[model samples]
Target: EGGVGYCGARRLKGGHLRGGTPAGAGLSYYYDPLPTNCVADWFCLEGNSRHLPPDPLQHPGARPDLNLAVFYHACNFNCLYCQNWSFRKATFSGGKVSAASLAQAAHERTACICFFGGDPTPELPHALATSRLVAAGVGRERRPVRICWETNGAMQEAWLKPLAASSLDTGGIIKFDLKAFSKEIHLALTGVCNSQTLKNFAALAARLEERPDLPFLMASTLMVPGYVDLEEIHGLARLIARLNPNIPYSLLAFYPQFYLRDLPVTSRDFAFKARQVALNAGVKRVHLGNVHLLT
Candidate 1:
C-alpha cells in the first residue's frame, strides 16, 4: 500500500513520490474564505450547520463563521449541464496551489473547508493532502474545522474510505451528486457510466452506522426537466433507502445551463412529486434545494 496509489486516472509511483509532485498539487478555480450563506439548502437544516457556535464542543449545529470553499478545476464526469463547465478550462491552463498555503488560508475564523469543483474526483490527492495539513494545524482553542466534499462519487474504491474518514472525523458531510440511476440515462446525461458512482456510494453506505448522530453521507439529484423524471427518482431513492434510509437525500431544482440551456427550469409540481417519491421509498430525511428555480 505504501508503494502504490492513485490520483484520478494517473497512478503514482509512491516510492518515488516527492514534494511539489502532481500527487500533492491542487488546482483550484478560486477560494472563497468568506462566511457567506451556503447555497445548499439541506446544509442549513436544524442540527446541521444552521446555528453552530464558535466552540466546537458546544455545536448544536456545525456552521462556522468562515467557510473556505475550495473550487477545483478538473472533474471526472462530463455532464451535459455542468454549471461550472466554464471553469474547466483552468484544469490544464493555470490555477495551481500548494496544500500548505490552502490550509493556511483557513485562518482561526475559518471553520469549514469544502472541496468542490467541476467535481473533486480528479484532484482527490491534493484535497486529501490539504485536509491533513488543516487537521494537524487546528489548535485546541480554535473551533473544530469541518472538511466536506461535494463530488460526483466516481473516484476509485480505495479513495472512498479516506474521504469518508475525514468527514466522519470532522463532523462534515459528503454530498454525492447521484445524476441518474439507470445506466442508460446516466451515460446519456454525464457521458459516462454510473456504475462507479453507484458502487462507490454503496461502499460508503456500509460505513454509515459508524457515526449515527451526524449524517456521514448524503445524496442529491438535479431534477433535469425531461431527463431525470419520476422513474429516475424512484430508482435512485430506492437505492438510497436500501443502503441506508437515514441518509439525507436532496432533490435540486435544475436551471438550464451549459449545453442543456434549451430545457425549462424544473417545475414546482415535479419537485414536490420527486420529494414524495423519495419519502415513500423509505428515506426518512429528504430536502428540496433551489426551490426558487422551480417555475
Candidate 2:
C-alpha cells in the first residue's frame, strides 16, 4: 500500500519520485517560457497586476509576457476523444524532475504557470509542491505567483481547496473541461461519471465572490460532433449559469482523434448554435475555441 497503486490511468507509487528524493515528483516532459498568442485571452482577466511579482524592481523578469507551460504525463479520465492521449505512454516511463527544478523554470517573466496534461488531477502533489515553491520563491512583497490549472476537475475533495487556494491566492484561474452533462453520454465519452467533476466545479465556483475582478473558475466543453450536442451544452451551461452566470465558458470545436477519429470535426453551424444556447441559458460570456477546426 505504501508503494505503487493504480489510480485511474496512473501508477501512483514511483510516479512521485524526482531527483532521487523520496518526495520528489516527476513526469513533467516539457517546459516553455515563451509567450503564445495561441494562449487564450481569458488569461488576460483584469486585476491580475494585483498579484504581480513581490518586487518588480528586483525581479526584472516579472513580466506577464511568458506562461510557463508544465506538461505532465498522467490523467484520471479515459476519454475516447483525448487530444493529448499520447501522454499515456509516458505514464510509467520515468522522468522524475524535482519540484524545485520545475519551480525554477517559472522564472520572473512567467505571467502564469499552467499545469495541464492528459489532465493534472493524477499528479497533483508535484504540481502543488511546485506551485508552493514558485510562490515562496517570489517572496513576500505581495501576493503569490499566478498558478493556473487546466484540469478534468476530478480531484478528490480533500485537494480542492489547496488547488483552488494556489490559484486564488495568486490570481490564477482553474479551467475545468466539462466533457458532457448527461450521465450516459459522459460515461460513454470519458469512462467516468460527471458527478465529481460537476461537484468540484460548483464547489470552486462558490468562491468566485472572493476575487470578483479576476474569474476564479472557468469551464469549457469539446464539441464532439455526434457525442456532445446542443442539448449537452445547454444542460452544462444552465448548471454553470445557475451557480455563477459570470463564469467564463468556452465552447471548443473538436477534431477527430484518438478513439473518436471516425467522427467528423465539429461543424461551424453546431458551434454557433451551441454558443447561442449557452448565452440563452444565462452564461454571461461565451467563447468559441478552435474555430479553424469547424468543418
Candidate 3:
C-alpha cells in the first residue's frame, strides 16, 4: 500500500498555448548564438536557427513515413502570428545546404520533406544545387520522395518555375501557404501584399492544367486576430475550386505566439466556422490545427 500510494491528482493546462519553445521574456523563441557568414553582404549569414525545437514529426521513427524537416532561416514575409519567427530571417545555416547529403540521409519511404521557415524561395539557387545532390541519390533508386515546400507564396516566377520543374519528374509535393487573401488583410497579417503570391498561384494553376500529372498542393493560412475573415477564406476557396476541386485547403488556428502575443488565440468556434466556410465555398479538404486533438 505504501509503495502503491497515489500522489495528488493533477492536470496540466494550456497545451494550445505551449507548443512553441519560449525564448527570453520578450523574444518568442529562443535564439541560439549563431555565427554570421562573412560573404553574404545583403543578409546576415546566421547559422540555422529555431524558435520551437526542430519539428519532431519529420524524423524517421517519429512517423513511419520517414519524413524530414529542412528549416531554412529568415523570411521575406513578417507574419505577425508566426510560430517559427526566429527562422523567418536570413541565416547562413538555414539557407544553403547539401541537398545531396540530405537525400543520402533519407530513406526511401520518406514522403514529406516538410520544407519550412526562413522563407525557402531565397534559397532556391542553393536549393537547386542541393536538390541536384539529393536527386542524384534518390532519383536513381526511384524513391517515393516529395518536397514539402512550405512558403508564404510571395516569391517571383523565376524561382517558382525552377521549383515547379524540379517537382515535375520527381513527383515532389509542393505545399504553399498563402497568408491571407485580400490585399489589405494580407498586408496586415504578413506585413506585405501577396499580389505576386496570387500571380504565382495562377501560374501554378496553369502549369497544373497543362501537366495533369504534376504533383502540387496550394494551401493558405490566416493568423488569428488581425486577419481571419470569411470573405477572404471564401475567396481563396472559390479561387482554388475554380482551379481544382480536389485541391486541399488547410485552415490553421492562429495562436498568440510571436509579435501578436497581445491578441487572443483564434477561438475554436472561429476555427470551426472558418473550416465550414471553406467547405461551403467549395474547398475539398480543409483541416484545422491548434485546438486539442479531436475525440
Candidate 4:
C-alpha cells in the first residue's frame, strides 16, 4: 500500500497491495498501491483558459501550460452519475509507478499539475509525494510548479492542512465538487453524507484569507436534472457566499452517464438559471462548465 493517507496522517507504506479501505481508532481513509495508471486524462497542456484566478484568461499572451494527472481505481464516493465510472473496473496491475517517476512527467513546460480521480483522496500519498517532488524542481531550475487538486473535499483536517498549504505556496487552486447542498439529497445522489465535505470546505475557505492573490479555493456542482435544481444551487451559493462571496463557483452541466443515463442532459436554460441563482445568492464569481453538454 504505497499511497498517501486521506487525512495526511501517514505515507503509503511499502507493500504489494493494490488498494483497500482502512480505518484507525477514530480515523478513516483509503490506501492503495500507487495504482497502475499515473496520468488518466492530460489536457490543456497549452493552458486551460477556464481555470480560476483569471491568469490565463486575463493574459492570453502569457498562458501557463498545465498537465492533469488522472489517477485510476480509487474513489470514496459512489455517484451514480459518475462520468469516470469506468475506473471502478480499471486494473492497475503492472501499471503502478513510483512517486519520483510520476513527478518526472511534470517537466519545465508544466506550470501546474492537477491530481484528480476517481478521487485523489484515496491516493493522497502518491499525489503528495509527486507534488513534493515537482515542487523541489526535479529536473529544471527551482521554478514554481503549481500543485492543484480536484476532489470531493472529504479528507480529514490532518491531511487537508498540509495539502492546502502546499497549494497555497505554489499558487495552485484546490477545486471541490460540492455535489449538493441538502444533506439528504447529497446522500441520495452520491451515496455518502456531505457533512465532512462541508466541514472541510469551511476550513479551507478560512485558509484562503492567508493568500488572497491566489485562487487557492474553488467549488463546483453538477446541475443534475431534477436533483440539483435552482434551489439547490442557491443553497450552495449562499453557503459559499457566507464564507466568502468571492469564492468562484462553477455550475456544471450534467450529461446522462453511468447509472443515471435515464436522465436528460442538463439544458442550457437550467445552467443559466443555476448561475442566476448563485449570483442572486451573493456569489460574485459563478460560471457554467461543460456547456457543450447543455442542449
Candidate 5:
C-alpha cells in the first residue's frame, strides 16, 4: 500500500516526487535526486526506421542530432540481463545534478535529448524539470529542443501523461521496452508484473491517435534466447497490433550479460524468425535491433 504521491512541491533530498500509486500490488516507490553520467551516444542518430515516427533520421530538415543522457542506477525493476548493469555501483552513490545544469548539457548540435537509464521512472521529477528547461530554451537561446524517453513503461499514470505530452509537442518519441506479455515470464525476467506495462502501452497508443503527425509511441522486446521465444513474440505482436498495427515493434537481439551470462547470445536466425512472427501478427513495421549482437 506504500506508494509515491504526486505533489509538485513535495521534494525529496535529491529529487522531487511525482505522485502515483504503484502499478504492481504492494510495491512501494521512492524518489532520489537525479544522478547521471551524461554522455552523448551517436547511435541514436539512426532512429527506428521500421516504425514511422518523427525522429532525427526522418526529419533531416530539423537538426536530427541527440544527446543521450544516461541516468545512474535507480529503477523499479531488478532485471537479470541488464546490459548496463554497471549502474548498480552509482545507483545511490553517483553525484546528483540539478535540473538546470543537466538541461544545459543539450548543446547546439543536439536537436533532441533522450532520458534513459537503469530506467527513468524513479527520477521522473528531475527528468520532467530538465525537459521543461530544454523545451523553454533555458540555456540554448530559445532554440526548440525535442524530448525523448526510452523507458520500461511501468511508471505511474500520473507521470506518464505529462512525459508523453512533452514528447508529442516536440516531435519526439516514447519507446517502451515491453519485456514480456505473460505475467509469470515478465516477473521472472524483471522482478515485476507486465500488467502495468501493458496498461501503459494501451494508454500511450490512444494518445498517439490524437496526434496523427507525430510518431508518439513505439515498442520493443528483447529476444533472450531460452526465455523469450517466438510464441512470446507473437503474443506481444498481437497485443500491439490490436492497439494500432502501425505502432512500430522492434525485436532486439539479446547478449549474455549480468545474471544471464550463461545464456547464449540471440542468433540472427532467431531474430529474423521473430520478426516474421511479429509481421504475421499484423504489426506493420517490425525491426530487428542490435543485429550486430546476433551470433
Candidate 6:
C-alpha cells in the first residue's frame, strides 16, 4: 500500500484497537492534503482551532482566533455524517516535509497548533512524535504551545491513553466527538459500537482523579436521515448529562453531503429543533452546526 497505510478497524487482543487489514469493511485508509508536513498552513486562530476562513456569516465561533494547524490522516470511524469524507477516504497528499519543517511552519505563525485529521487520535505514536518535535522546536524560545486534537471517541482508551496523558501537560484541547448515545446508533453510523467510547469517556473521567486540570470538550453532530432522529437525540442528551454537563456538546445540523446527498438538507429549524431535543433531555449548552443559527 503506497499510501497512508491503515490496517483494520479491528480490536487487538492485548493491544490497542486499530484499523486492520484482516476482514470486513477492511480499514478505508487513504489520504488528502492538510494532514501532512508540507504545504500545511497555520492560521492564527485562538486556541488553534482548524476552522475554515470566514465566509459570509457562517463561522461557528467568532471569538477564538485560529492559530496553527497540522493536518493528519486516517480515521477509525466511518461516520455517515462525516463532512471530510473525501479527505478521509482519499489517499496521499501534495506536500512532503519533515517534522522539523512542520515545527518551523508553526513557529512562523502562532503558538497554538491544531492536530487536524480524519481523526488525529488513531496514529498516536506519530502524533506524539510530532508533538515532541514541535515542543522541542519552540522549547528554547519558551514559546507557548497548545496542542488540540479533534477526534471521534471510536478508538478505545488503549489507543487514546498515550495521547490523553500527554495532551494536558501541553495545554492541549481534547475535542472528543461522541457519535451517539446508543451503541446501535453508533454502529449504524460509524461502523463501531459506542461501548469502548463510553468506557474510554468514563476512563478519562477516572484519569482526572480530582480535576487533573485538563481542557476538554465533547462534540457531536445530529446526523440526518439514517443516522439520527428526535428520539436518538433525547437518548444522546441523557447520555451526556450523566457524564459532564459543563462540556459543550455541539448538536450540529445535518446537510446533504457525501452518501447523503439525496437526503433533505438540514434546515435551520430542524437544527434548532434537534438542539431543543437535546435540551429537553437535559443536555446543557447545545450548539448548532452546519446551520446559520448563530449571528
Task: Look at candidate 1 and tell me the lDDT of residue 209.
Answer: 91
Worst 10 residues of 5 by lDDT: 20-29
Worst 10 residues of 1 by lDDT: 1-10
* Per-residue accuracy of model 5 over 1-295 as CA lDDT, tens digit each: 3333331112243365433112111111222221221111111222432343454433354543444444534677889999877766654452466676666677656656677777778777777777787777744333456677889999888887798888887766788999988898999999899898899899889876776655678888999988899999999999999999988788888989999999999998888899999999999878777888898
Instruction: Give per-residue lDDT, candidate 3, residue 43.
Output: 21
lDDT of each: 0.78, 0.78, 0.56, 0.71, 0.70, 0.56
Q: Which consecutive 10 residues in model 3 have the weakest lDDT in total?
A: 19-28
Off by over 4 Å in 1: 1-26, 29-50, 53-64
Kindly give the stretch of ten consecutive residues in candidate 6 with the minimal lDDT sum: 21-30
| lDDT per residue (tens digit) for residues 175-267 in model 4 | 899999999999999888999999999999988788775468889899999899888899999999999998878888899999999999999
- Give candidate 4's TM-score: 0.79
**Between prediction 4 and prediction 6, which has the larger lDDT?**
4
TM-score of each candidate? 0.86, 0.86, 0.69, 0.79, 0.79, 0.70
> Model 3, 1-295: lDDT tens per residue?
1121011111134432211111101111112122221111112111122322344445534422344556655467777777776652334222233444544555555443545565666445545555565666654334435454667777777777777866664655566787777888878777787799888887777676544543365575753654667777788888887877666567766666787889777777777878888888877767675455221
Q: Could you tell me which residue pairs clash in candidate 5?
A: 5-19, 6-19, 14-33
- Candidate 6 lDDT at 290 equals 51
Candidate 4, after superposition: displacement of residue 175 in Å?
Answer: 0.3
Residues 1-295, candidate 2, lDDT per residue (tens digit)? Answer: 2354333333335446232231554456444444343224545442234434355544454444567777777677889988888877876666667788888887656667888887777778878988888888885553456788889899899999899899888878888999999989999998888999999999999999999877868998999987899899999999999999999999998998899889998889999999999999999999998888788
| Residue 112 error, candidate 1, Å | 0.3
- State in Å the error of residue 58, model 5: 18
- Show pairs that collide, candidate 4: 4-125, 7-159, 36-95, 36-96
